[model samples]
Target: MIELRNVGLKYGDKEILKNVSLTVRDNTIKAILGPSGVGKSTILKLMLGLIKPNKGQVIVDGTDITNMKEASLYSIRRKMGMVFQGNALFDSLTISQNLGFFLRENMKLPEEEIERRVEEQIQFAGLEGYEDQLPESLSGGMRRRVAIGRALIFKPHMILFDEPTAGLDPVSSKKILSLISSLRHNNNLGAVIVTHIIDDVFNVADCVAVLYQGEIIFDDVTEKLHNAQHPFIRSILSDKILEL
Candidate 1:
């Protein structure tokens, strides 16, 4: 489980997040909704320990990880994977090499073991034929899949996704959404998805947290989100339906 307690972040008085609190249970997908520049990405960075929050604590599985040393944080990150907005695959690396590089370099595993793990991740993301291909050669959706493949290669217990379906066509977005949902259900990897896509909440989330401005406006079970009577949520949901 992941817990944020009274978490706040600031950048020289320009606050990015304020008094934020949220809890994400294990073996479930937590769908986060918010507009761009509203600290959604910042929250992920905080959880990853990339940046420190000015106040409060970040707890994962009962550990108050707010002030953990870098060594411990590095080990903790082994159980976490983050997928960025642009897929973030290294342009010069082959798909298989991209996924296998970390395992080979970081774990210093044997060549055969690396090969086996890479093959498994390739099959896991259904990118069997594209192992030798570069990111530039694949479509946008395929690039994201490769990114997902790399994340899965580590067998993370916690997965953080940033805008998994931003700017894609509806069909592609839906397919990616299904992949995320399937991962948690099939692999028991906890997922935290930060996206603006309303359809995504319904399709992929077990719980949803809404952030407005610099604060967490609502956090609840997916089925119970609409019961909060949040004016902003209602507006967003209404607008999303109209777009459909």
Candidate 2:
């Protein structure tokens, strides 16, 4: 499980998060919902220990990682996979190379094992025939799938997604959402999805935490969001999508 205990952060006098607390259990999907520039992505970075909070603690799988050294955090970080908003694929590498790149770079596994893992991810992502293609040639949804496959190649216990469906068409968005739902059922992997789209939250998240003005205004099961009495939550429930 991952827990953030009263976390706070400041960036050159501008506060980003303030006494924010959250918990994400294993084998479930949690969505962090908020408007643009509301520090939703910052929470993901805190969970990964990529940035240090000015106050509070970040616990991942029973380890206090808030003050842990970079070297020590490596193993802890490997337990979770991150998919960036931009789909961060190497344009020069083919799909197979992209999927197997980390394993080959980080592990001393044999060539055969790397190939096996790469093939497995290809099948899992439903991109079997596109294995030899570059990311640029595929559609936006396909590229996202490739990015997700690359993340899953690590076989992490949990995945962190930054705007997973931000730029996709409606059809593509549905496909991505379906794929995310399948992860919990098929792979038993936990996920934390950071998004501004309300429908996305309803489609995939089992629980949600609503961030606003650097504070979490609401945290509970997805269904309870509609009943939340907070004005922000009520506003978002009516707005459906938080572009502002």
Candidate 3:
């Protein structure tokens, strides 16, 4: 489980988040919705302990990681995985290498163990035959799957996705969404998805939180999001103008 309690952040004179509180329960997907530069990604960084909150606590499992030492935070981070928006794969490395890199370099696991874990993750991502292929040689959807596999290699308790379906075609997007839903249901995984795609939220998210002007204006089950009459929420959801 992940919880942000009255979190606030500032950079010089700019405030990115103000009194933001969010909870991602086990076996659930919480989608954070907002336009660009609204600090959606900042919340993920806070949860990962990549950055500190000026006036709040980021609790994961049972530990408050907000002020944890770097050494202590490393242990906490190992329990979480982050999938970046750009698919963040190394073009020079093959799929297997990419999946096993951290386990090999950081965990110092034996070759057989690394190979076993790599193969398992590859199969889980449905990339059985693409193990030796480089990221550049695969389709966009395949590359995205590799990125997901990399995150899943360690079997983290929680995963953070930054725009998982940003540039995929409809078919690929739906496949990724289904994968996320299955991960939550089958593995009892917890996830926080930061996205501007309303359809993505409606399709896979159990809960939705709307962030506007650095504050969350709406937070509840996905079904009740449309009931919000706030201008920012209404403007973003309206299909006629399609501001988002």
2 against 3, candidate with superior lDDT: 2
For model 3, the stretches where C-alpha displacement exceeds 4 angstroms are 240-244
lDDT of 3 at 62: 85
lDDT score of model 3?
A: 0.89
lDDT of 3 by residue, 75-183 (tens): 8888988898888898899999999988887797889998999998888889988999999999988898898888888889998999898889999999899988888
lDDT of 1: 0.85
Q: Find the 10 residues in a row with the least total lDDT in model 1.
A: 235-244
Provide the global lDDT of candidate 2 against the true structure.
0.94
Query: For residues 18-98, could you state the per-residue lDDT of candidate 1 as single tens digits?
Result: 899998888889988887778888888778888888999998778888999887888777778899988888899999999
Backbone clashes, candidate 2: 0
Poorest 10 consecutive residues of model 2 by lDDT?
Answer: 235-244
- Please rank every candidate by TM-score, starting with the best: 2, 1, 3
Q: Which candidate has the highest TM-score of all?
A: 2
TM-score of each: 0.94, 0.97, 0.94
lDDT of 1 at 167: 71
